[model samples]
Target: MNTPTKRRGCFRNGCLALVLLPLLIFAGLFWAHRSSQALPDRFVLVVPLSGGIDEVRNESSSLPFLPSHESLSLQELLFVLNHAVADERVREVLLDIRGIHTSPAKIAELRDAVEKVRKGGKKVTAFLRSAEDADYLLATACNSIIAERGGFLLLDGLKVESLFYTSPLGKLGVQVQAAQWKKYKSGIEPFVRTGASKEYLEQINALLDEFYDDYLGYVSKRRGMSRSSFEALINNDPLVSAKKAQTLGLVDGIASFWELQRQLTRKVSGKELARDNDVFVSGARYRSAVAWPQKGESDERIAVITMSGMIVHSAGEMGEGIDIEMLKNSLDAALEDKAVKALVVRIDSPGGDALASADMLQMLDSAAVKKPLVVSMSGVAASGGYMAALAGKTIFAQPLTITGSIGVYALKPNISGLAEKIGLGRDVVTRGQYADASTPFKPLEGQAYNKFVGASGEIYDDFVGKVAASRKMSIAAVDSVAGGRVWTGSRAMKAGLVDRMGGLFDAIHAAQQLAKMDMGKKLQIILYPEQKSWFESLLQGRSASLSDRFAAAVKQQVLHELLPQRQLTSMATFYEMLLTSGQLQMLAVMPSDIIID
Candidate 1:
């Protein structure tokens, strides 16, 4: 066919496709809705909480066109649990918590939801194989906890570990120069000190003590054990068998999957149950059926936008972190929605890219002028994460959440000695005397070093000023707590850094009150940055295709067996180079690292 003829045919095809698309979508949705409504009534809902729980559902792992059988996001699980509370068809909930791993803070949220389910008069049974500290903590909220025989209950208490790089950096002939506005800002300590400083140790120990006490108290209350005896039992036999756990009053009993199902059936329906023939509703299917609100029902909405992982200036290709532009877009959308009466910013990050944080804070502050804005800090919301929280009218955090670390630092790596050891040297040409001052071949000295000090001072002062203004404290008062020091949520609340010592639900409650919504009524939750549908994602190329994902998975396995990971070292080196070269300036990041076990 000629070019004109071909163009006309293509145009006609496009028109036809567009016209039929909505009808096709309606038909598909209608069939699925009808089938869901036709499901048999009055069955036990099996909520299988397995694998890692994420803040948001990860679309990268599943092909857009295919049905996903992956682990549920925290939001989805909460939705399911809440739905079951009012759902007449769901007689009970079987919590099949199998080999699931998550942070303690997340466990607290899940535990709260489980408690709500129980309060709603639904019996919740937890089935487990091996019970870790977090897993058991969650199971405590359930009415009955059944563990498999021979399974281990590793309830060793919490310990926080940090990594220090001062010795290693020194060996590489790199000296890190850092200045904090005051003491307690220990973010740079890891790069300059061999071990935790006395101040840092004191703060960390106090934080750990508080967290341990709270956890012990909760577990003791839930299991109906005295705190003193529970502590002794934990210390004496932290890692015990399932039977020992039952003996210690940690779990209800030991039973296999089949046995547990039979028990659940009898408990739920007061009758005998079969092996694999029970009509149990999958949590995912149940969630789909009840996730949406009833049509034409008027419910006030509170928009929740989650910012998890490192906060960066631009899009990250591989890292599962927050992007400034993406967050800005989400905020704009939430603000524009008339249905959304309030906003909640859920921040869980270790801090990054100070400039990006500033921009986001500015946007958040602007948004708050029109609507109530609240922050829910999860896990680690230090430095930039804390900065973003400042934009909220109120900040909420868990008792163990790591907050603060309001500080900035610059790292300059001088590898002159390393070059000498390798029989190599470099001579730089520059337009000005100070042009080559920060070159890697030499340590910054005199005027060059002073310039960095001045810049860091300004950044620190700016940070303190903002904190004071937002927190309604004097500059000196803010400085006392701002010196790059990390604080537990309880301490932060005492210091006026956080308004409430609670989790996301608390933040939501605060937002609801601020919006003047009916507290007893169900407030519709609207997630900002709406998840892309399969078709939308494919059209936008926001995620990888099925073939591409498979290839990447295979490549990862091959590389895992063949290569050593030097990426961490290389990334640090590159970052130092960038800072020294004046390409990247300032950082509002947590000075220390944390790993909880």
Candidate 2:
């Protein structure tokens, strides 16, 4: 019954079907991956806290074709917690505390957020497999703390260590010539001395004492124990098993993950579930299911500009530091936007170039004149970072924030001995007396050293003057607290350096109040220096290409194979800081390399 025309038509239809089938399948898979899963009627939100917690979200990925692995930021965590407060469907919040690495300031912020969740009528429980000092501190904010049967708690006291390279560099025949404006400017001490100076020792011991007292007070008060008892317990047994922790009232219960899930199910639904998955929703999925309360469609907006890392004149790589040009553009855009009623500048920098910091301060001041500006200091905002913050109408910092290193220093490396050891020499002819002042083969002395000292003094005086004007204190009072002295936010507040002791959210609320926005109504938030995807960054020249990145990785591998990686890396980093703005520039930075373990 088949004819030639019928056979041809059948073949054509078969070919078309084969091509369409693969296209349909591909489309289906894409939709499935992009779509959000349906939420259950009532479920406990499980939030896993781990890894390094940053202040802002990072969108870069190694491979452009694949999605980047999500890392948690304080902003995102806060957004989720704030949304959960009003969400009636969420029965409870389960914080799965793992190996979390962040500053004490961030930990304090998160603890406050957990307390706010409890205040909103939802119980927050912390589940720990093993806990460190910071983990225990955060867990105390929860309604109850549950630990795995075999877990341990390491409650070791805090210790800060300072590394010095003076001996090693001397062995290499390289001497560092450093001139600081004040005695307390210990940033250069590590380069010049084998041990900490007396002044530095005094400052560091004071900082540690304050931190230890604050830590003891917070933990003891939260766990319903006297300070002396808690101090004695930690001193006696820095490490405790789960059973011991329970008996000591540190943990409410010792149970496995499944047991905790069963208890949660019974508490929420009045029945135990056969499967743990039936009652729990992950924080990642929950984020997709619920929209942020502050991100409502509103014409009124508050622009948040994040200035993290060192304050540099320009960055060679993206996110290298707070570049002056980038800050200028962000400020200009916020000032120009009519919808932006207020601005919140979050600073988390240890400071860098003195000139760039002054530029940033000027930009913020100009922006503030047109609209309200508030500064929120993160973990470490010292030296030039503090200078830039002077423009804020009000400044907010957490209790553990390290701020106020109001001084300047200049460093010049004299490598004449190294050159002699290596049998290398240079003959120079100069027209001017100070022409060779910056040469590495010569040590800065006589008129050259005097000139640099005068410059540093001027910069230091200007810094103190700005702090005095901003804090409304006399020059003597400001100087008394200044001179490269760092203080915690609580002490800074008492010293009249900070207007309030709070976190980023508090600063946002202050901005909202200043803008005259109704506190009950949610307003939109606009992030400055807007986050970009990897592909977009490549296209816009903000990020290096794949080939360039590959080359960098190869070079890093080769260096690790060739050298003592840690020491070499440290030296390279220090050298980079010296040359960040090109030439031997004076730095208004802090002793940021100190490690608090």
Task: At residue 430, give the lDDT of candidate 1.
Answer: 75
Evaluate all candidate structures by whole-model CA lDDT and list the values in order.
0.74, 0.80
lDDT of 2: 0.80
How do the residues 422-468 of candidate 2 rate in per-residue lDDT, one tens digit apiece?
99978899998999888878688998889878888998899888888
Clashing pairs in 2: none
Which candidate's lDDT is highest? 2
Q: Model 2 clash tally?
A: 0
Count of residue pairs whose backbone atoms collide, per candidate: 5, 0
Colliding residue pairs in candidate 1: 184-485, 185-483, 185-484, 185-485, 187-591
TM-score, every prediction: 0.83, 0.86
Q: How far is candidate 2 from the true structure (C-alpha RMSD, Å)?
A: 5.7
Q: Candidate 2: minimum summed lDDT over ten consecutive residues — where?
A: 563-572
